[model samples]
Structures are given as C-alpha cells and as structure tokens.
Target: MLNYLGDKKDERMKMRNRYRKSTALRCDAGSRCLISVVIGSLMGCILLLNLYSAIRPADEIGQHIHLRTSHHLHFPELEEVEEENIQIPPPRKRSPRATKRRPKKTTTLIDEFLDEDSQIRHKFFPDQKTSIDPMITGNDSMFYYPGRVWLDTEGNPIQAHGGGVLFDERSETYYWYGEYKDGPTYHAHKKGAARVDIIGVGCYSSKDLWTWKNEGIVLTAEETDETHDLHKSNVLERPKVIYNSRTRKYVMWMHIDDVNYTKASVGVAISDYPTGPFDYLYSKRPHGCDSRDMTIFKDDDGTAYLIYSSEDNSELHVGSLSEDYLDVTNVARRILIGQHREAPALFKHQGTYYMVTSGCTGWAPNEALTHAAESIMGPWETMGNPCMGGNKMFRLATFFSQSTFVLPVPSYPNLFIFMADRWNPADLRDSRYLWLPLMVGGLVDEPLDYNFGFPLWSRVSIYWHRKWRLPQGWNSLK
Candidate 1:
C-alpha cells in the first residue's frame, strides 16, 4: 500500500511539471508576438512620416497657388524691377567740418547726392529747366519723370514734400497735402541736422494726379507767437490729412517739435473744404506721450487712428482718434517697441494694415522695414523691407529716400504710389519726391512661423524706377 501511494504522488508531481512547462511556452510566444506587432507598427509609422515629409512641400506650393487665385490679378509691370547700377565714385577729400558733420558710412553716391559742389549734382537734383513742365508736356503730359523737378499748373515747382494725396468724392479732385519746405536749409545748432524753418503745410489740387495745381498754403506758421507750437522756430513735418464725413471737415495731423526736437507733440488742424485754409488747433502729446514722426490713418468705417514714434524715438505708439477726429479716445496701444523706426507710411490692403518705416538717421536715408497688423491698434508684425529692384546699395538705402506716405490707387487694388522724400539736406527746397509703384502681393522667400512657415502677409514690394507713370486710364477708370 505504501509503494502504491508513493507512485500516485510521483504521477501528480509529473502532471504539475507538465502544466508549468506549457504555461511558460505560451507566455514566451505571446511576448514574441507583441514584439513583432510593436516593430511592425513602428515601421509603418516611419513610412507614413516619410511620405508626409515628401508631400508637404508640394502641398505648400499648391496652397500658394490657391491663395494667388483668390487675390485676383497679377501685375508684372508694377513689379518690374528696374536695376540701378550707379557707379559709386571714389570718395573725395573732405574738410574738417564735413567729416565732423557727416559720418563714416556716408557712401560716395550719398556724398554726391548731398554735395552742393558735386559735379554730378544735376544728376540727382536736376535743374528747373529740365522740369516736367505741364505746359510744355503736351505729348508727354502724363509721363512722370521721377527725381526730376515736377511743375504745377502755375509754372512753379510743386512745394509738397513728404506729401499725402486725398481723393475728395464731393469735388472729384485729389487734394495733396504736405510740408511746404520752400525755404532755405540750415542747421539750427552746431550739432543739429539740416532743416527748414516752419513754412506751413502746402496744398495742391489735381484732377489728374500728374497735373497738380497749387492750392496755396493750407496751414501757415505762427510767426509772432514764439511759444506757440507752430512757431517758425519749432518743427512741423509729415502732415497727413483725412476727411471726416460726420463733421464734413478736412482734418490734418502733423509732428510738432522744437528745433532740438525736445517738445515732441502732434498738432491738429481742420478745414471746411479740401482746398483749405485749415484752422490751426493746439498741439498735444497723444495719449499723453511724446509724439514724433507721426501720421493719421482714417479707416473704412470712419475710425481714424494716429501712429507716431514715441519714447524718445525708441518705439511707436498707435491710438484711435475721437469721433470728431480731433482727440485721442484712450484706445491706445504701443507697437514695434525697441525698433528705432521713423517716417511711417500707413495703408491698408484687403483687411490687412501695413506700415513702411525707416531707420532714424536724421536726414540721411536708410533701409526700410514693413510692419503689418490685422487690426489698426495693436500687435504689429514686421515682415522685412518692402524695397526691391534696385541694386544692393539702392535697396539698402531705400532708393535714397525716406518713406512719407503710401497713396493707394483708387482704380486698382494692390497698387499704390509710395511717396518718399529724397531729402536734399543742403537745400531743403530742392528736395525731390520719389513716387514708385508699390505692390502688395506675391509670396516672399522668407517663410513666417504661422501656417507652417507659409506667407502670413502679402509681400509689400516698392519697385524702383527711373521714370514711370500711373496705370493707363487709372483716373478715368475710377
């Protein structure tokens, strides 16, 4: 009986051992299967990632095509880049006074442009005899000779420098307003930059933009009132005008400062007519901040805003004006902080607001940068310079001009006249106007972060041209 019981025990032990071996085999097989599944999933995922990477660039191109189709037409002539290969002559000897005033970065071409004794002075600042005389331009009536003297209907050179053009619906005429710097240029102090005394804002009237008629001084200076903001010893620059429909008034805003630019403020003026004897109002710091190099932009919905360089010219301030377009409404926001930019030119295209600004080099020209925003008030994004078509130097120096205003073409979308001041520091009265075709479309080479490095804003291109004209039938088309 004991031997039998012992044999039963051994049999039970053998059965237990067999069960344990089978369970171990099953667990090993399951582990192998899970490993295989994980490897397969990883391989498939890698293949999918590779395919996506390969197709994404083409998809981006397709998206660009889709965008272009939505924006409508493509204008090649407006973007045609006229290459300027100006032979930069060798630097000439300068006197102690010249070297002390002019910095080392002053290129030979800039020297020529600024030199009163330069042999090629006429090349940059052409004499009045070769002016685009509207009286004699019978066949060449509409042609624009850029950088040359532009004459008005009364046989006088147009005095509108740093100008903005306004199309009046009531009178069916375009009124151009700007600084009338027809006075002599001189430095106020030994360290001061070249400037002209306050000569008031000049107004010009035009049916065709090419043929402007002088509308006399719309806003004059305060000659007797020495403490007044518009005093002749003070500074007035970059005068911009907008029509207020509710008030039926023409409102103007300008940068008001002292000779040393210490009293930085914005002056306001208003008139009952487009060709106005605008009443000079007081000057004040918009939003109670120092304002300089300023411009006022009126929106489509009658909301007007002021944009100016503030904080001792270290940044920019933007704020909305009141209902009457005379005062700030406390709806203010600062933008482009730490970017030392001035000479702002603001315009909107297809629901996007754009501004062109230059470096603060006083009268000397510098590179231009374009900032964009969806709203007029806050969070502006810089998208690089808008200048194109010139050589490296010309583009770097903004075609040797500073931005003043961007005049939209009423007849065509995405086409604008980029009005700039080719400041003749030696003679402010001889300052030339640089109006070029500004196009606001096309994909830029530099990719932005949003939309997967796609173009967030349309490229702002200010094409360089030696001579050009408005598109055919531009005025008539409107």
Candidate 2:
C-alpha cells in the first residue's frame, strides 16, 4: 500500500510541475524567455523576408526590374547614383585699405546660392533653352533631370511650384495644381521673405504623371481689387486640390496671407471640373487659429483633412473638412507641437499616416523629418531623416531642397516620389523641382526609441540621383 501511495504521489508531482511550467514560463526562463521568443520570431521573419525579397525585382534594387521582365516597355535609363564633389573657390582679394574700410567676409555655397550675380549663377539657374521638352526628346522621353528646366506640351516652362497632384479616376488622368509664380520675384520690404505676387494657381493635366499639358491659370489673382484675399500684393502659395465624390466638386485649399504675413488664413475655392477657372469663395483662420504652409489630404474614406503650421508655425494642427470639402469642422487636434516644423506633406500607407516636413527656415534647405502615427490625429512619432545614399551633408540638407509633396506610387506599397523645391531665393521664379525616389523599408539607421530597445518605425530613404524616371510599368508592379 505504501509503494502504491508513493507512485501516486510521484505522478501527482509530475502533473503539478507540468501545469506550473505551462502557466508561468518566466519561472524556468527568468523573464528572458519573452525576449528570446521575440528575437527568434524576428529572425525567422527576417529570413523569410530576405528569401522573398531576393526573388522580388524593382524593390530589392532601386531600379524597376519587375516591369522590364513582364511588359518589356523601354524606359529611360534608371538614374545611377551620382555624387557631386563641388569645391568652393577661394575668395577674391580686396585692397587692404578697402578691407579695412569694409571687412572681406567668408562666403559659403549657400551665400552663392542666394546671390543673384554670383559667378556660379549658371550652375544653379541653368538656361531654360536646354529644357526637358518631352515633345522633341525621342529616346529621353521620360527622363527627369533633377534641376533642369521642365516644359509642358505647349513648349512653355511648367509654372507649377509647391504643387500637389490628383489622380482623377473618372477621367483617367492626373491634375496638378500649384502656385503660378510666372511673374518676377520681389520682396515686399527689406526684412520680408522672398515674395512673388499672387499671379494665381496654375493647373496641368497629364495622362501619365510625366509630360503635363498646361490647363492655364485655373484660379486667377485679383488684379484690381486691393481688398481681395488673392490681390496681387498679397500671398497665395502651396495650392493643393482634392475631388469630393459626395459633392462632385474639385475643392482647392491654399495659404492666403497679407504681404506682411500677418493675416494667416486659408482660402477655399471650388469648381465642378478639374480644369477650371475656379470660383474663389472666402478665406478664414481654420478652427480660429493661424494657418500657413498648409496641405490637404483625402483619406481612404471620403473624409478629407487640412493640416497646417499654426502657433506661429511652432506646431502643426490637423482638422477634418466638412463633407462638402469647403471648410474645417470644429474638431481640431494639434500634432508635432514645439517641433518648429513646416511645409507638411502628408500621405497614408496601410492605415498608417506619414508626413514629411521641413524646418522653419525661409527659402532655405534643412534636414527633413518623417513622422508616423497610428491614427491621423495625434501621438505621432518622428522617424528621423528619410534621406539616404547621399553624402552626410547632402542627407543633412535634404539634397538642398525643401519638402513640397510626398506622392504615392499606386500599387507599389512602399515606393514614393519625394517632390521638393530647390528654391533660388534671389529669383524665386528660377526655382527648380527635385524629384527623388523615396522608399520606406528596412531597419532604420538611427536608434529606434529610447523607451524601447528597437525602433518602432521603418527607415524612410530618399535616394539621390542626377536623373531618374518612373518604371514604364509602375502601375502594374506586382
């Protein structure tokens, strides 16, 4: 009886141990178990991802290889990574007496960029005669020269700056709208920022994103009415458009300010068609707050929102527009406060919201920041600089360009086009567009987060290239 009882007790002990082991794995593993599991899962995922990525084309390398394999469409040469090793020439000698009277100061490349009569002026503002005219350029049809002057089908230089593109599904075309700064550039006062009179917003239509056809000045500035919000003496910049399916209206939202930038407001205009002489309606401080350097985003749903720099551009605010896409609703949420970020370009991917913003420096290139949020409204996290593959200085200065827009490549999950302006402050009309490839993937280079051991965000990379073109079969990239 004693032996049987001992056997039963031994069996019960084994059962108890098994139950305890399953319930509290930490007891045997010392809490390192969870981390081990995580790491193991991560490594397994990495292996699988690497295997799949090795087989996939167009994504592994920056070039679009998948399109070439299937469709056999001939695209311009995929721009190779070219680096610039420009050196600053020595300063000119001045007479000692003249130097004593007026000190000979050191000048930087930035100073050269801001000086209209600098000896290197041609380097920045190349002659428009050698422009990218798609009509006559046979083999170079889709080639994009980063700083070269770009012309439309009408043989006129494209005037769309600080622009946003809208893919019109109904018409099966893309409509791009932006500030039409075709007139001369000037400053309102000695200390004022570089200004271009409100000549109005220009629109361009394209079957492909390349080779635009000018739609003329869709929204004209008020030439006579001085009190008008769009008066020639005032400011109208960064115009973005979105179509409302519910209202069937193409609504425009732009930064409308006075010459001194004291009246910081957003103007609303609407038309029934994409190409239009839009009817200017009114301007207002959205949510009873100052708005500037703004952009409009349409969500996967019909809901659209306007995001702008507020609190004197120290922070940004996002609020949904009314169903008609005319004005802001009462609900407004502040984001990236005290970050001193401006020129927000927002886009969404796989239900996560992402934004690219520049510093508050006027007409100067600064480091670009990419932010991600689970929700569109709040608690956003900075994902560090999205620039990669350039020299350290090039990455830091955003390739000498400021964020204007982040365009998504349809059907291509992580591929995007980073559109920016290489502003020529001396003559804003000579500003050039910088279109670079932006991709989001891989472990970020920066330390992920202080609160956690690894980064929660993916690295956003903008590859630097002298000339690049979209893969011929971008839409069908599987």
Candidate 3:
C-alpha cells in the first residue's frame, strides 16, 4: 500500500510538469504570431504611403517645400492667362470656273490659314521687320515673339524646322537639330505631299536658348546616289539627338521615307560631338512596321526610348533602345492605339510621364492633346487639349502650330518650354518656332474612363502668349 501511494504521487507530479511544458509552448507560438502580424502590418503601411505619395498632386506633398525654397523660380508672369483675339478676314472672291470645278463648301478659318493670299497672313507669319533679332539688345532683348521671324547670330532666319533641342552637360550648351529645308519646296508627284528634298539635318548651338550659331549641314543629302535613303528625292524630317553616356556618342534619329511617303522608316546616325558630321548608319522599320513622325527621349536613368507613329499613323509604339542606344529591342508596347496621334513630344515630371501629340493633319495645324501615364509603356489616358489662354479658334488649332519638343527648364519644377512649329506649307523653309510656357499642375479637367471619379493625373497646360520670355533669371540656377 505504501509503494502504490508513492508511485501514484510521482505520476501526478510528472503529469503537472508535462502540462506546464505544453502551456509554455503554446504561449511562445502565440507571441511569434503576434510579432509576425506587427511586421506585416508595418510593411503594408509603408507600401500604401509610397503609393499615395506618387499619385497625389504636386502641391499636396512637397511642392510647398519647393515653393518656399525656390521662390525666385516662381513664374507668376508666365502663369498669367494671356488671351488672344484673332479676326478672320472675309474670304477672297473665287472665280466662277474655280467654283464650278470644286463645289462651293462653307469656308472655315482653317481655309484662310492655309491660303497664302489670306488677308491675315501677316498675323500668322509676320514679316522680317518684326523679326526676333538676338543681336539687337534693348527692352525687347531675350523676349520671344511667337510667329515672328527668328534670326540666328548671322542675321539670317533660323532654318531648323521640326527640330529638338539637346542640353549637353559636358559643354553646358544647347544644340538644336532638325531638317535643313533651305532648299526649295515642291511636290514630287501630282498628289505627293509638299516637301523639301533632303538637304540634310541642320545643327545649331546656343549658350542661351536665344542666339543660335549655325553648325552647318551635319548630315548632308546624297547628291548622286539615286537609290540611297538620304537621296535628295527622299524625305528626312524631325531629327532628334540624344547623348549616350556608355558610348560617349551623340545619336541622331529621324524619319526617312520616299518622296511618295510610302517607304516609311527611321534612320539612325551617330557622331562624337554635338555639332556633328554624323555617319548615317542605316534605316529600318522598327518591329517590322511602318514608322513616321518619331521622337527619341533619354530618361533620367540613362535609358533611351523611341516613340513613333506606327500602323499608318493610327497609333504609336513605345520601345526601349539597346544598351548602346543604337537600336530598338524586341520589346515594344503600342500606346495611344487607334487614337491617330503623331508628333509625340514626351517629358516626365514627378515620376509621371506626359506627352503632347498632334493629329495626323499633315502640315496643317490641328488640335493638340496631352496624355499622362504612370509608366512610360502604359495605358496612357488622354487629358484633352492643353492649349489655354487663347481664343476658341486658337485653342482648336493648337495655337496655329504643331508640337515638336517639350524642353524642361533646369532647376524649375513643373516648368517647361513648349517648342512647336508654325508650319508654312507654301514656304516650308520660312516656318516659325512657337515657344510657350507649359506648366504641369492642378487637377485634370476631364474625367478619366477608369479611376471611379478620382483624379489620377495633373493638368498639362500650354499657355499661349503673343510675346513671352523665360523668367528674368531662369538660367541663373543652372
């Protein structure tokens, strides 16, 4: 009986010990689960904060800090909405035979805009008397008069039409590149588009945006090679240059096509210097599709991309270039599909991509649309016409101009120079450059198809001005 009692007590003590060990194990597991939940919650909160910072308006987050720090960069003068009033003159009387051949349709302001003999032609293309001469230093010095003749340092009108400006960090100068259309303009066939034979790509250098020094024909046309792509009979236009840091070379890309414009392709050229006699490498149809009206953009991360009108100008394709910045990769995403956008001038701000595009209206100025995307290759949403301050007709016609490039102002957040071409189809070489202030801020005016009533992008405004200049000391911070 004594042995049995002892054994029973020992067994009871062992059972108590076992129960305590199991309870301790359960408590440890519960503590571990609580720690995991806390860590996971922290990570999720961080992700949500980052996402909010990206999509929020510039003024909401740190734009106030920028405003306080860079008060000198504030451009209240540029932000002021300047209205324009253009009176379309009465139509010229047409002859009976001319009227009979073409039935009398209701004439529009666009008709007057295209007519060389339009009474308001001077309004669109002012004569040399009111040219923007950089040499003449007075109250009007450094001011930009849009639609007026812009003379280079040599007292000759700048001939870089459909051009883009590159700010070279090494030399700290801006280089402008475009089609050298100093040659005569004519139609190749009865129905061919009016074009100036490939006189070559022109290069001009400038310390300030004003006062350009001609760099001559950087890439000349082939005079004798009838089958060559750069032959005088072919088309070469919208040449853009971007520097490759890895290769330390300047790459030039332009639209190459036949006079008939059926052979649409892009040509590439490279040079060691900004003012270049570039070697024409070759031309190709990127992704085996017809390309025209293209532009190349070098991102802040040193990656370059090519955006071109493809599939008969019904859509645009965005693709990354090779590491050397010479060729496109197999990766291509078609954005703005079926929107019929061309003249793509892309710029990024506050981690968002913005583009200004024109309609496929040939030389005639059409409505300009601004698009925004969270990613470069993305589902870009159209944000309506960016033209502001101008009258109804002026806004409708993109201020009588087509977008060529959107140049960011150094050290000035959300400020850019909107460069465009006031095309003169009758006299192609006499085209004028329209530089206006483009600001990215405020809520988007149009509702997005997605987003469920929430604003997803900022408004891109290209404010029109008859005469405007960069803020007094815009380049001082540079």
Candidate 4:
C-alpha cells in the first residue's frame, strides 16, 4: 500500500511540472505579440505624420491659426472684379509745325497715356472739381476716389508721391514719406527724363489714411551746397522710413541720383521724430553696385533689409542693414537676374516673402510681376502679373500705375493697401495715388519654374477698382 501511494504522487508531480512549463511559454508568446503590435502602431503613426508634413504647403505648415483663418476668409466686396473699358478717341489733327516737330507713329493706349494733350486726358486725370477734400463733411467724407486729386487738411493736393507709410507705434499715427515733388516739372536736357528739382522728402501724418495732414518738408534740400546729395539739381525719389527700436531713431532710405541718373546710389537720413527735420547722413552705392528704385523693409525681428535695382536695373540686389539701420551689411544676394525689374515693393505674408516689381520701362507703367520666396534673400520665382479686375490693356499696364509701397492694413491679415503711383510724366506733382486692395490667398496662376509638381506659394492679387474704400469698421479693429 505504501509503494502504490509513492508512485501516484511522483506521477502527479511530473504532470504539474509539464503544465507549469506550458503556461510560462504561453505567457511569453502573448507578451511578445503585444509588444509587436504596439511597435507597429507607433511606426505607422510616425510614417503618416511625415507624409502629411511632406504634402502640406511650406507656407502653411508653421503659420499661425488666426493668420490662416484670415487669409481664407472670402472678402467678396474687396475682391469684386470691376472692369474698365476705356475707349481711345480718334487722333486730333495736328498743325504742320507740330507735325514737323514730332512725327506720328503707331498710337496705342499707352501712347495716349503719355501724351499731355490726349483727348481722353480728363479720363486719366480728373479735374480739381472732383478732388477728395477730407475737410468736406458729407457722404464723401471717408470714401476714396482713386485717380482724383487728394487734398490735405489745408486743401492743397497731397505731395506724397513714390511714398511709403510708416506706422509709429508710440504715437499711433501713420507717417507718409515721399518725394515732395510740388515744384514745376521739366526735362533737365533734351534727352533726359522728366523730373522735378529736389525739394526734399515730404512727410504727412494721418489718423485715417484718407485724410492726411501735411508735415511739411521733413528733409529739406541743400539750397547752397551744389555738390550735396539733396541739392535741387540732384534726384531724390522713393523715400521710405522705418523706426529703429535700438537706436530710437527714425531712419529713411531713398534713391539718390544725379540729373543724368548716372550716379545711382541710396541716401540715408535719420530723424528724432516721426514728423521730422531728418538729418541727411550720406549716400553710397550699396554693395558697391549702382542702386536705384530702392525700398527698405523692416522685418518682424527688428532686422531691416534694403532691396534695390542693380546691374543697370538688369537685376535686383538684397542686403541686410547694420544694427543701427543706417547702412547695408556685407551679406548681399542678387535676385531676379537678367530679368530687368524696378520699382520693387516688398511685403510678407505668413512665412512667404512677396515682392511686386515693375519692368524697367522708365517712368511709363508696365506689367507688374509678383515674385515669392521662402526667404527674403531669395532665389525668387516670378508669379506673373498680379493685376486683376481691369480690361486687358489696363491689366497689361498695371492699371497705368507703378508700385511704390505695399501697406498692410492694421488688424486685417493678408489684406494690404496696394499703394502705386499713376505718374503724370508731364506734371509729376499731379501724380495720382492708386490705393487698391491687395490680397494673398489663391494658388498662383502661373506654374513655377521649379515647384516640383506642387505650387509653392499663394497668389498675390491686386484688385483694380475705379473707386474703393476699406471695409466698414476697419479702424475700429485697431
């Protein structure tokens, strides 16, 4: 009996050992399977995230949510396409003496535009009877009638031409700086371009951009110094001002040239106040290159850049400014090479940089091309003309205007005021301001040269309007 009990216990012990081994193996297999599943899921999620990032638009990837929303908003009123069909009248009979002085050639709409005696001159330059007098309290109080005479608070025509707006945060006012070309216009020589003697840079202050209060000639011409850069015989155009926080100074940059336009250089000036008696510092060719048709852009980080037409206006050169905002740095890059462009007006949206430039067609208006880059110092890609809502000829001629500065409307993301000069070569002081709506949103109309199967940036559209105003409650947002 004892022997039989011992055998049974031994067999039961053996069976229990085998059962424990099997249970241990099963638990090991289950743990391994769970770990594999977790690892696979994690890998799959990472792969999807990489794919999404790769497909997303570069400009949109790191953009702010509010900016994205603002850009996508449908501003139908501002974007409304208004067509203008201007009919060129038949040529008037000229006297034999007049015909002998000037031979008649193929006359296009542009030809009529340059002619001071054009039969449709009234169409381009409306008489003073239709002037935008801000002092007048009526239905036209704040409405902007583009192409009409814009009078200051004193009832004189605003002399800010080829100008730029500087928002002074401390005073919360907009200071407009430009060539104060209020003098008589004439050609320096028989073969020279139409010009007005330097009267120094004009500054105008405004709470609302429509109603300007003249700040007088902030930077006065050097009357006695014939060799001065600001001498009456010299040329000073496109004066842009930006405030430097570090230096606590308002710095101005302008295109300074001789009467023959042979000395293409940039002049620098500094002011203690926004409405300034700016002190003229000096002038130099930036990067040792002949610079003209220049503009200064102050970036969000307080860094500033100078962009100018170089290589005899065959290309554009961009360089950073010294910390003092007084001079250009050694870092420079040539952009839009061999593509003769001038009248550069640059603005940033989201993470992309955009520039509106005109062909090097002297004072006459030409097609405006918009270029974009991921960087400011760029390998810029031309995005074709941004003009919209005009007739074919109007669009082709940039609405008979040249870009000077692009002002971003406060509190309105992606919405900017396209400030251009409808230059009257015959009378530079009579130049009209074309402040139209410029928006950045839709895909580019023209395929880029190196987009690699996807569009790189948003389309820049400057909508044309015979007359347009900012949306209601624009100032309230500020």
RMSD of each: 17.8, 12.8, 16.4, 19.3
How many residue pairs clash in all the candidates, one count each?
0, 1, 0, 0
* Model 2 quality (TM-score): 0.82
Supply the global lDDT for candidate 4: 0.87
Candidate 3 worst ten-residue window by lDDT: 18-27
Off by over 4 Å in 1: 1-71, 91-107, 448-452
- The C-alpha lDDT values of all candidates are 0.82, 0.80, 0.86, 0.87
- 1-478: candidate 3 lDDT, tens digit per residue: 2221245457546544643433233347659888778869997997787688669887665564454334324468888877777777765688989989987777667787899998888889999999999998999998898899999999988888888999998999999998888878788888878888889998899888988999899999999999999999999989999999899999999999998888899999999999988999999998777899999999889989999998789889898999888898877777776689999999998788999999999999999999889889876878889998878888999989999999998878789999999999998999889999998876667766434343555688998888888876767237
* lDDT of each residue in 1-478, candidate 4, tens digit only: 2221245457446544633433233347659888778869997997787688669887776464335445565589889979887888876789999999998776888988899999888888999999999999987787877788999999999988998999998998999998888899999899999999999888899988888999899999989899999899999999999999998999999999999999999999998899989999999998778998999999989999999998789888899999999998888777776689999999998888999999988878889999999899886888899999889988999989999999998878779999999999999989998889999886666867544333556789999887778877887227
Candidate 3 similarity to native, TM-score:
0.84
Q: Any idea what lDDT model 3 has?
A: 0.86
lDDT of 2 by residue, 331-428 (tens): 66777766899999998765668899999988877899888887898667787898765567667778778888888877667677888888888777
- lDDT per residue (tens digit) for residues 392-427 in model 1: 878888988999999888768778889998888888
User: What is the lDDT for 351 in model 3?
Assistant: 81
Per-residue lDDT value at 253 in model 2: 95
Please provide TM-scores, in order, for all candidate models, with all chains considered together.
0.83, 0.82, 0.84, 0.84
Ranked by TM-score, the better of candidates 1 and 2 is 1
Better of 1 and 3 by lDDT: 3
Q: How many backbone clashes does candidate 3 have?
A: 0
- Summing lDDT over every window of 10 consecutive residues in candidate 4, give the lowest-scoring window: 18-27
**Best first by lDDT, ranked:** 4, 3, 1, 2
